[model samples]
Target: MLKQKSGPSRRKVILIGLDSAPPELLLERFLDKMPTIRRLVKNGISGRMRSCDPPITVPAWMVMMTGMDPGQLGIYGFRNRKGWSYSDYYLTTSTMIKEKPIWEIIAQTAGMKSCLIGVPPSYPVRPIMGNLISCFLTPGLEKEYTYPHELRDEVAEIVGEYEFDAAFRSDNRDEILEAIRRMTNKRFDLANYMIEQKEWSFFMLVEIGLDRLHHTFWKYFDDTHPRFESGNRFEMVLEDYYILLDKRIGELIENCGEDTIIIIASDHGSKAMKGAFCINEWLIREGYLKLAERPEGIVSIEDASVDWDKTKAWGWGGYYSRIFFNVKGREDKGILTKEPGGDLDELVTELKEKITRLVDNRGVPMKNTVFSPDELYKTVRGDPPDLMVYLDDLNWRAAGTIGHGKIYLEENDTGPDDSVHSMDGVFILYDPRERIRKDIGTMSIMDAAPTILRRIGLSIPKEMIGKPV
Candidate 1:
């Protein structure tokens, strides 16, 4: 167990997690429109917070809360390999997280109560010292979503059948827009109610609507998007949503009172997606992955008949690519050996070189980055991919489907996504008692937990890698 010390003073902390909020949009472009956020930045310390590698939501949010990197957490993405098996995998849940989060730590050390809402992988709600509500990852309302069980009834009374997530990937923009608004409004309503009704020293709520908005309506507002056009029907949609968000934030702050410490943060940033790179197709063409028979149309790699005996590697796709090597003694029908100066090592080297030097559709060099799990994290814990790839610095998502007959695609393979997650998210920390309008510049996402712990009069855990800001 980690040791803790008591301090002379303790203050309430409110963490507003805005999923996929970028520094460029929140801090620069839309700052003037969000009066609440603008005032927070003006009175507090703000900066570009660097998100974790593979910068996706599940691991990123957990990373921020636990003060651990993805590798240390053993969670690379939403779905992870169960073992070395070809197909066995599991969706991450609260049960998988062994590391203690800030709430649990504070509850144990300082005896502080917490009211948490919508923190990722918080489904299958676990017991805490105070109130809790599950995140968007919750399957449905039928399952218990609150820590105390009865808290679910209170939530339902305030917002009928709580909206966990919005289907923003749909082509029906109007429907999705309405769904996003409804979800955001209901969530904020619940948050305000929790603030007034619950007794707690720490409160954290993550809003997933901003991420949905970016992915669904990015092209309409961002002139730089490849598919962008002037005066699109949804051009003002994003701006309007941000303003609404600001209004809700204002209310949330009002409920917290003037002495509370406020923090606005994002797990990862967002950006206009350039395109999708058909990673499976590229691997097949490069002779790393072998298909027994050609897919007649675009099909998931899982559905295709892969000749494992002849396949050296294959890849799964998302905002980044997770490439796995079929190694001897590690996988069934394994071909490559893991010995030093052997086939596996040589193949990894070759793939990294070729992938980094890849060019885009226009034959222009893409600034791709590749990493091994050991290279990115202090401790490699989970069944990590053989190689993690970021195409064109994450502007281009990786498509896991095959039979496209080409490597480049103009849209996301799974849905109509318009934006990709970026590296630099936004963060603003405000203390009502102090008006330090300081620009802290860049901070790591890992720094958030320790910073909060330090500010709230708790000693930082020795295992935590980040220093308090």
Candidate 2:
């Protein structure tokens, strides 16, 4: 255990998380457009922040807050395996986070107050040292979205209803953009109000509009995009949204006191998506997955016609792929055992080799990277997949839905999502109180928790894997 100092700490810290913000897009491409970030970079440190393996939102953010890997935290992605079944999955929530977040540690050890807003996995809001507002996982505003139940109505009245996230996948581009603007404006307004009215040592806020615009309009902006169109009407949509976000960030920076340490970071970055690689399609072709009968139309992997008894392995898809085996005694209807050569270990090795050799329609190898639990994780817990994979460095996503004719799907099953999560996020740390180091070559998302704790003069527990950067 790490001990805390007795006296009151004068230093304050403010952290702003820009969801899915890439350094290439912001720091290089649109740096001139973002005056606030440019100013921060002039005096502070900026670098490429390396995201976790399979850099999806849920695990990435949790890793940043807890300084723990997904294996240790028992969270892999937005959806996790519910049981020993082949297909069942449950959405991750605040309850799923077993590790104590940095905010709780700060409050417990140093008796410091923290105001956290729109941080994911913070739904079903609990009592924090200061105020709390739940993240995108919140079911609805009608339900309790605030720490103090009464704060919900007060926030709504002051900021005109909290916006969890925008429906960017909808076909109505105009309506989607309008909703995004409204949501972003209200979020900043609420954040400004909270900073002014509330008393706190650490304040953190996460904005999701950037993630929404990247998903909805990256194709319109990127010339190398597979589905790119020249001179498209929405080509400037993503860039314009960033400009708007930068202005609000500037306002927030101006409002903060000089003693405060400001850190702007992202869970992961975004890149133009190539397409979806159907993981289930590959499993079916390889005879690992068994279907009851030949189907003419598209069907979910969980279809009743599927035979679970004969199935040896299956995959769940998202920004990355999670492969599971029906090991005997582990799964209820498992057929294979860990006996001799023909067992769970052998099956995993065979599948990994076969999947990495997969080629696209043009005969170019997919060059997928795969990781087993023992290979990637420090401490394993819960129902982790037998194999975790990233296809084409996450430029191409994975999909489990069968009946897509071939292995590749041109569009997302959800709708028109143009971007996929990337490993290179942005990190900018500015502290006016002290002269910090000039440049940090690369930083990990896991470095955030310990670093923040140190900034606010709190102890970093021995259990945390990350050291202050």
Candidate 3:
């Protein structure tokens, strides 16, 4: 997707990602509140980006930064299922990534240094040009103080007394709040210190707070929920957070020299997903699947858990589900040659359509589309799941292509789950006309890297999925 161009690049680019930040929240509403973001938008080019197909965090981020598809990055969805294989959650730096990342390109070609703080799945740091301090969804962190012969005192000061490891998955709100405060403090300290110490070419920071809040509180903030929180519900909460988040961003930009370029982008927007669809269960009910042990009719899912060795596939977590084709060689005890077939594709398409056509428990039709690897992929190297299913505004889907059947529709989907991710990610750019930034349509989980590079005067790599903006 590289179209070579000649141009003057900014010496310094600061890309701040407000994870799951929706453009609506920032359009004149939270500008005063999110001073930093507001300032960046005002001083730079800004726009609303529509995320790619199956707009989950992992794939979406990959799309935004590298401009590559999920098929290329090998990051299919929230968790990937490989046939009778167990599903594994995706964290950025996980061994699952299959393509060239934007960081490598920036460091290798741009002749610039970067400071990346707390971008998800970036923890087990890989080869890169700058210092990377990572956390898992802002909850799990390795304090610089813990590093061998660490500068414990200095790192502590920079990270502040608070450190948030709050994940949307965590059931505890107290812990979540504490983690958020800590994470925010650490993000602030890290960005500030990095800018001061390093003549950084790009300083990229992503705020995971908004995303977390949406996941945990969407139910309390939406009209459908009897427990919807806040008198203003989700909309007002967004504004409040924007105002608070803005001040932090403002401070970061305040210290920057006029020559420095600051850009703000989100991996993808958020939407509410309350209904749950366990594709694996649906397959079993349809007789497409069989299990050795069904767990005495079901008390709780844990009680009814199937024999992983017996079932063809299963899925869980978040607003999506993965359907695995039980093929041999690919699975622990696979049955087929693991070849891709038209049958497999068609079956998935049918199931996906059925899932999309579903009405929520409240009887509302889901709105979304399914993307095969080719469809999800725009680049030669696509990072898509075996099959990708994008859901409606309030409904999302996940699937795994690890089975042998042409169509292994589940008899039951995971139970009716409440809440979904947010749809409000932000994008503010300086000189976005850069070849790297020109095609950026929407933000995703993967965009932070290359965008950071472009801001710092680095050219995106030919092999990488995304380029600098």
For residues 1-469, what per-residue lDDT tens digits would candidate 3 score against the true structure?
Answer: 9522213554667777777776765645456666555545555656666565555666666566566666666665655543233443334443455554555555556455666765555545444566666544434444332212243355566765535445545557556655665677677777777777755566777777777766655565456544455564244544555666777777787776666666777766665554445454556666545655554433322234445454444434345444455445565665434347744445565666765675544566667555556654654242234544444553543322223122222211233223455444566776534313232455444454566554555555665554443
Q: Kindly give the stretch of ten consecutive residues in candidate 3 with the minimal lDDT sum.
A: 404-413
lDDT of 1 by residue, 1-469 (tens): 8533234498789999999999998999999999999999999999999999989998999999988999888999999987888777899998989999999999998888999999998988999999999999998999989989999899989999899999878899999999999999999999999999988899999999999999999999999999998987899999999999999999999999878999999999999999999999999999999999998887997888999999999999999999999999989889999999999999989999999999999999999999998999999997899899999999999999999999999999998999999999988999988988989999999999999998898899987878899
Once model 2 is optimally superposed onto the true structure by TM-score, how far is the C-alpha of residue 372 displaced, in angstroms?
A: 1.0
Error of 3 at 346 (Å): 6.0
Index of the highest-TM-score prediction? 1
lDDT of 3 at 240: 55
Q: Which ten residues in a row have the lowest lDDT in candidate 1?
A: 2-11
Clashes of each: 0, 0, 80
What is the alpha-carbon RMSD of candidate 3 to the true structure? 6.8
- My TM-score estimates for the predictions, one after another, are 0.98, 0.96, 0.75
After superposition, candidate 1 runs with Cα above 4 Å error: 1-8
Rank list by TM-score: 1, 2, 3
Q: Estimate the TM-score for candidate 3.
A: 0.75
Candidates 2 and 3: which is better by TM-score? 2
